[model samples]
Target: MSLARPRALVFDWDNTLVDSWGTIHAALNTMFARMGHEPWTLDETQLKVRKSLRDAFPAMFGDRWEEARDLYLQAFEALHIERLSPLPDAEVLVQAIVARGHYLALVSNKTGRLLRDEVAALGWGHYFAKVIGAGDAVRDKPDRAPVDLALDGSGIAAGPAVWFVGDTGIDMACALNAGCVPILVHGPEGGLLRDEEFADATPARHFRDCMALAREISQ
Candidate 1:
């Protein structure tokens, strides 16, 4: 199916525009060690890390979730900025999309302060109309709350015309919940097969990378 040109574009941060798995995995392991939990391998981290800390930590750490949260955040803040890197053609894609006059926003499961910090660090803050991260709204992604917050003052409502681009099933679920068009961007290593990992909330479109998605939008 052909994609409708988006009236607005909403992007996910980690693994969508920026490559953050290494930072995420390292931080998670750091937290695991301090909490006396088993450290996850990179592949395990990729598969298991999805929901926000508030949403996922309780399940993992029970009553000690807050402690785990603090530990994880400290480790992440220490390493994320130093190791942060953008995916190939990510900035080019953002520039091209903005140049086409489409309203843009960001909705990420990453913590709000950390997400904004990463954006500012990359000098890409100006590219988005609103950057809604975890805890920015009453609820996180897949609930449609953050999606609403992201588009709040943009004069754009969440619908088919708003393309929610990301790299995970959570993203596709968010798009589906918010009535936006789900657009998946897979990495060069080929992560998240649409028919397999995302069968329940499949993307409306898929691209191999940022460059491919950029080309599709340009067409």
Candidate 2:
């Protein structure tokens, strides 16, 4: 599939831009332990931790979901910044895109405060016009609310001119729901999860890594 040059870009912050699974896994395990549940293995964390805590916790913890959420948040907040790590060439890619004058925003399922904290910790806050995260919008990703909130003040509408680059099926689905061009930048392993999971929301372009995507966009 061919990619249209973008006027603005909306990015996914977790695995798409940064490698945050370590912190996420640890935090999830801490919550599970507190609740007397079996902790997920790292692989299970990777496979199951896609949706926002608000969206995913209820299913995992039933009536005690809110408590689980608080526990997970506390655990995550305590260590997230220390555990933050950029994927290969992700920082350079974002800097290069900003240098080229493309308007940028981040739309992540990560909690708003934590997401912004990580962004600030990395000193990359200036690169984004908006950093929309969970609870920042009326609804989170896979819904159009976060996408709309992200582009709210940019004077840019959501459509093909807006490229949504992310690594998960949820991100692809969000792009489609928002009428933006969906571009998948899978992590280094490049499976991008199961194909059937997002079969209805196929991406317009797919890149194995951020560096490859950066090269194409810079051209």
Candidate 3:
């Protein structure tokens, strides 16, 4: 794909840099069962988990959303680190970018403390200048507030010089909303936003995985 080096890169954590779907799916099901709600299949989890818990839980759990949120956090906190899985070549890409001296930040829908813990667990915390997550900003992804927080003090304005990379439509929408270049990081094995779906977002590029993206940007 045609490209230029970005001044800064902001990434979506789950499924973009790491494979957390299994852990996330299991944790969600655990919460659901405890709440006497039907558990979501893994496929359902992938389809539905695109927003921060604050943004999505109210609609999913109604008046009891706070209780469900607490339960989900308890379950997820217990299992996330043990179940955390890095996507292939993700670490290499992170290293490559750092080596080239590009600023890096993470903007995730995951709870703030939980997201930082996962990054530290992988020993990749040093690579990012900031790690903005749910509740870390006034608003979250697809709203531009988190993106603003992520790039703050990095000296890079949010525009073409910045790239927001992720695997989902929500991520793309966030990038577009923030006026950053949207780059889709697609995993060959998953069912996710297709090319047609991304057309509306006007993504700057699409790579099959981290390796493909690293090669292009690291050049």
Candidate 4:
């Protein structure tokens, strides 16, 4: 597969750009405990909870999805920023791309306001043209709805030229459903859970971190 030089590049937040797993794990553990469910380990939570909240909340919370949503948000709001940090090389990559003038957006399962706040906090808000998150559409990643909302009226037509980069299988599925190219961003040692790996994710190129991804694209 030929990796298109993008007219606009979109990214997934969380593991792809930042290391907020501690915050997430803590909040989720608390949320789950409050509901009398066994708290999931960080790995387990990442594996089972990558779907957009809209898609996963009902199944996880049943009739209490709304209540659970509030609980999760409250938990997250309490600690996410305190534990937030950019991935080792994300900024250099984002900056290099901005320098090249390609439009950039973020498609993440995170809440919209929180995601925006995180971006601004990192001083990286200036790089993204738009950031589409969990509530940005009726549905989320792997559903095509959020992707549609992301592209709608942006004047950027859909298809392969649009690359969706994230650290997991959910991101790959999102790209596939959206009919865009799927790019996996993994550590150089690359260990991710099963079932999220795509049969066709050739990766066009692999990078150790965002800086590496950007350096390659720059070359």
- Which of candidates 2 and 3 reaches a greater TM-score? 2
Best by the lDDT measure: 1
Clashes in predicted model 2: 0
Per-residue CA lDDT of model 1 for 66-103, tens digit only, reads 99999999999999999999999999999989989999
lDDT of 4 by residue, 113-218 (tens): 9999899888888888788888888878877777777777778866777877888777777888887877777732544333335555434444567876887668
Q: Give a tens-digit lDDT track for model 3, residues 1-219.
A: 566679999999999998899999988999999999998888888887889999999998899999999999999999999888899999999988898899999999999999999999989889999999899999988899999999899889898899999988889999999999999888334433444545567567778989998997678
RMSD of each: 1.6, 1.7, 2.0, 2.3
lDDT assessment of candidate 2: 0.89
Order candidates by TM-score, high to low: 1, 2, 3, 4
Q: In order, what lDDT does every prediction score?
A: 0.92, 0.89, 0.89, 0.78
**Model 4 residue 77 lDDT?**
94
Candidate 3 regions exceeding 4 Å error are 187-199
lDDT of 4 at 20: 74
Tell me which of candidates 1 and 2 scores higher on TM-score.
Answer: 1
* lDDT (Cα, 0-100) at 113 in candidate 2: 91
Using lDDT as the yardstick, the better of models 1 and 2 is 1
Stretches of candidate 4 off by over 4 Å are 187-196, 200-205
Ranking by lDDT: 1, 2, 3, 4
What's the CA error at residue 194 for candidate 4, in Å?
7.6
lDDT of 2 by residue, 17-53 (tens): 9998899999999999999999899999988888988
